[model samples]
Target chain A: MPTRNDMLLLTGFVAVVLAAPFLFEPIGAGYPDLLQKFAIFGIFAIGFNILFGLTGYLSFGHAAFLGVGSYTAVWTFKLLSMNPLPAIVLATLFGGLFAALIGFISLRRTGIYFSILTLAFAQMSYNLAYSVLTPITNGETGLQLSQGDPRVLDIAFGRDYGAVLPSSDLFGLEMTGYPGFYFCGAMLIVCFYIALRIFRSPFGMMLRAVKSNQNRMNYTGLNTRPYALTAFIISGMYAGLAGGLLAVTDPLAGAERMQWTASGEVVLMTILGGSGTLLGPVIGAAVIKYFENIFSAFNKSMLGDIFSFLPESLQSGAVSVASLFVGEGWHLTLGAMFVLIVIFLPGGLMEGIRRIGALARRKKPGGGASASTPAE
Target chain B: MASILTVQNVNKRFGGLKALDNVNLEIEAGTVHAIIGPNGAGKSTLLNCFIGRLEPDTGTVIFDGVSLLGIKPHEINQVGVSRVFQTPEVFGNLTLRDNVMIPAFAKRDGSFRINAWKGVKRETDIEAKAMAMLENVGLARKADEIAGQLSRGDKRRLELAMCLVQEPKLLLLDEPTAGMARAETNTTIDLLKKIAETGITMVVIEHDMHVVFSLADRISVLAQGTVIAEDLPERIKGNPKVQEAYLGGAHL
Candidate 1:
């Protein structure tokens, strides 16, 4: 049922995602670790948008689902098998289960109260996983696969790793480096396709109605609670898949993933890239990850090299000033960019792109009519 | 004619304020019934009780032989009742067509369904029906326009179209022409007349005597939380009690 424009968008999206390694080489983000993070967080942000952007339910505890997914994946690896497929599947299921529990409770309230309830539940979960749930989560050290643990499925399949720990895999392809990135990238595409379908569906329309006017929806004989809960569960599963992919690439699950800061990061990504648009969240994720990895790597010596063209006294002063905006201060740059984007383009980066497109079309003789259509 | 809605011995209190004091009314099928009252006559409070928004302290509200009390607003709607608020409650962020289409979907799909796999564009039948409803209200030309940007009269019309798309057994309209110019009010009266011709039972709450006389088959005049008069529109105009309670004995 996709329109021609939708088909074209999907084709272009797939092509760009598949060619990311080469396309990003010039920008110095072609490496596998950062590329994997991009795909993983992209999935996370897109899922978050389904709940936050469409329904206007800004969850500040989505990181709890992400962390739950990672722990589930790690447990699957340690107790069942090293196959990333089963690990990922279990992670998504567990994540959805957790979301259902939390959503049922938190959704009883709305507005700022709902936000606070979700935050409270997530903090409770983080504390539980960090301290009391040490038997399963490994306390402060995090949950990791051990050679001594039983691998019922792997042993049954005649796979053996005597002393060295084994990385998660899909059949014979090891999930590490480029292969790992490709695996996560493929999942990202699948997730994007599913999100796209939901966006074009009746259910998505109902979710938007919930945001528009719950009282109207109720009087129209449409139950808004179930629709909102379903979106919450679906988004939770996506966060779980992203978390499982993280374990597939790195084989580690830590409590830090559940921190409120991690939750806020996804919110920033969605808003910065434009929450409601299809491609905005993924762009936001990539930009944030790119800054986190690339800009944070900038050192004083690198700044000195770039500013060497200036006079010696001015060069030192410039490096000193610029140094506070990169490396450990990369967050400052991100914060400034967020402020600018919110001020100049309240609709996010996608709005800027749309304006440019509108401008270009307006230059054509008859294109002005279509170009003047209001943004959704 | 069979009564579609029967309210008996209904009473409500808001902490010492008697909002509804033993109110009773009956709406026959396929007739337009208007409940006219001065301000603070418990007109809206009675409407709220019928729609499950407020729980009356004591009463029975029966619609189609089923109790309307102790049900959710959506459950009440599912039982073949729909309402248009005094202030239009259309989905402001969505297009006018979408606003109508949502109620149509609710009617077809029931209270809830996960129609996530099928594209909304594939529902051609609902699309056509939504357009037809918009055309009914004379908003078809602006069907794609955002509902929020519409004028007050246009939004009320859009809300009516939204409710009509459901084809409910009984419709409840509150102040259908509350804040409209004379021209817009006449247009709405004509539109409501057209809908009344379709044989759907309606309960209208209004203060405008002109709109009331134009649309109501029978009238109930409420004053001080009690029905002071209930009769045909012509008789009610000359009823002494109605004039004394409503207009302080002013001549009609």
Candidate 2:
């Protein structure tokens, strides 16, 4: 059970997530598709942070769980129904089981060895899903509700499978545009709440201990392995939930989802936003997704339009330079940002924000001796 | 008194080097048993055997009538044997209070417990007990501080608090006062003496004769992977073999 403070934090977080679409409108990212992507990837990053951030065990193969979740959800749609609820449930359960299997083997080693094991497992899964498991995973064409698929529950609901491709839904609520974004957003909030509970619990302390000093923790009378394995499984299940939501929103499960790059994207999100902080990964996900979708669309003409206020010659020069940072070159900007964050804010964006807050507090005229006590 | 820990005919080797050779020890309950020697005396290697960090090739180590040979290090701790490292191994990333609280929680919940849903704030009894231990270590003011930022002496005290919080049956110290100034070493001696008065058995490995003499009730001198002498602190000080192997070389 959450305490009163926990309840309040959850309530506040839910409000922000619910209001995100409207809040993001002025920033040009409020569209349902991008918003949905934000929520789904936010869940992925949060889950990734539970293992990487808290436990300091960086598994470079979380995409395996994500791909597993997507495949399970797609399979559920093909065999059971178009209703996303059951698909999500199965995806989470299967994702946890897969994580447990992988964690049992991979957690035997520490540091880079553990990461390499997870990476190897993810690559194996990707290859299997693409080639050998083509009959089930549908190869490069991806898994979908085909004309001949036996959606037993959908058929019983009086839906015509012989007609057009079925859109995912929550009962009669069509999962697209506003409704779909809200569904994904709600799931993000729920995942965040679970993460919050784990953070405040004794289990979280053990994980931190594992991260801080596993050898010391061993002598302190903690089996450390179980704690790390539990963290890995929980994070894997979170990734799976995100993957399930991806299938729910788009209705396709691809083997590419399990690729190492997909795993790297979530790691980038966690570190860019601040790995250990609660709200850091969510913000990092939002920033990265926004750059990937919105910033990548900026062309020479759009840049020219924004720089029109300057003189004609200066505008042309600025557009050429800015174009290198956006559009097809947006990764340059991302790389530079990553470098700056790593060098200046080793703790990530959260640490930068903390320093800024401290400086501002110190600059306040009323601040005196107590302000000099040093921030924790 | 009954033996709290019994190591019988233990032998360990790394290829050609004998880390411990036919080492036998019987630690009486409720006593401070200090092991002293020069470098390469296998003090740490012998300590490792007790904590399950290293397995003796052929030996029997029984703690409270339970065999500790096959058990893991954490299991040894759960069975009431804890070790303090030479460099003061601690959860440096966590707060001093948390560093102590973790051991208290470990003692209460055994080696492993899934208490993810229960809030740490709700574990008031644990928090209070941890706080009291911090106070006992003279780190009450620094309890909220990050443990990594503490001075060397304080870190040692914090480690002592962490071990004492578990209330272990046997506390093993490996150079507990290593890298300490004269004053800090004296403070640690006093602290160990205070902990000793509680009747908890301690097997301390130290090069610092000052610390050894101040707290040890019985002393064992190890020379070249073997126990050359075992007697009261005064008797071991005068032993000819001990003097040649260790005490004489120390310029004491």
Most lDDT-accurate candidate:
1
Clashing pairs in model 2, backbone N/Cα/C closer than 3 A: none
| TM-score of every candidate | 0.98, 0.96
Q: Against the true two-chain complex, what DockQ does each candidate achieve? A: 0.89, 0.82
Q: How does candidate 2 fare on TM-score?
A: 0.96
Per-residue alpha-carbon lDDT of candidate 1 for residues A156-273, written as tens digits (9 for 90 to 100): 9999988999999889899998999999999999999999999998899999998899999999999999999999999999999998999889889999899889999999999999
- Residues A205-321 of candidate 2: C-alpha lDDT, one tens digit per residue: 999999999999999989999999999999999989999999999889999999999999899999999998888999899999998988799899999999999999899999999
Across the candidates, what are chain A's individual TM-scores?
0.97, 0.94
Error of 1 at A169 (Å): 1.3
Q: Write the per-residue lDDT of candidate 1 for residues B1-252, one digit (tens) a residue.
A: 999999999999999899999999999999999999889999999999999889999989999998999899999899999999988898999999889989999999998999998888999999999999999999998988999999988998899898889989999999999889999899999999999999999999999999999999999999888898999999999888887887776775
